[model samples]
Target: MCKAFEEWQEECIQKGEIIGALKTYKKCSFAKEETLKNIITDFSLSEEDAQNCMEKYW
Candidate 1:
């Protein structure tokens, strides 16, 4: 579920695990665009950054 993914991401960050957080984000199957947008906004990342992350992970 989305909530689980969100929690997993948070936990990964709390543990200083960027790779784990990214991997978990890649596993989320619903509303990917919305999620990417949130990531961009939250992290101040560019759309290209989001695309690159997706390409690298997925």
Candidate 2:
């Protein structure tokens, strides 16, 4: 929980690296669409989150 929060914060603050963060998150062994949904839901993010993140960072 601590680690997840920390990573989320990093992704939020480090806008230029959000795509890398998302890719890393997606590639994690623990990743799943449901988990991703939960993360986005918990953060109140949307598909724009991924798109904007990629556009800004990648």
> Which predicted model would earn the best TM-score?
1
User: What is the Cα-based lDDT of residue 41 in candidate 2?
Assistant: 59
Tell me how far candidate 1 lies from the true structure as C-alpha RMSD in angstroms: 10.1
lDDT of 2 at 32: 50
Candidates' C-alpha lDDT? 0.64, 0.58
User: Residue 57 in model 1: shift from native, Å?
Assistant: 1.7
Model 2 agreement with the true structure over 1-58: per-residue lDDT tens digits: 6999999888767553444556666677444555456446555678667455545533
Relative to the true structure, candidate 2 reaches a TM of 0.32
Quote each prediction's TM-score: 0.48, 0.32
Candidate 1 per-residue lDDT over residues 19-53, each given as its tens digit: 44555666775366766676666666689976676
Worst 10 residues of 1 by lDDT: 14-23
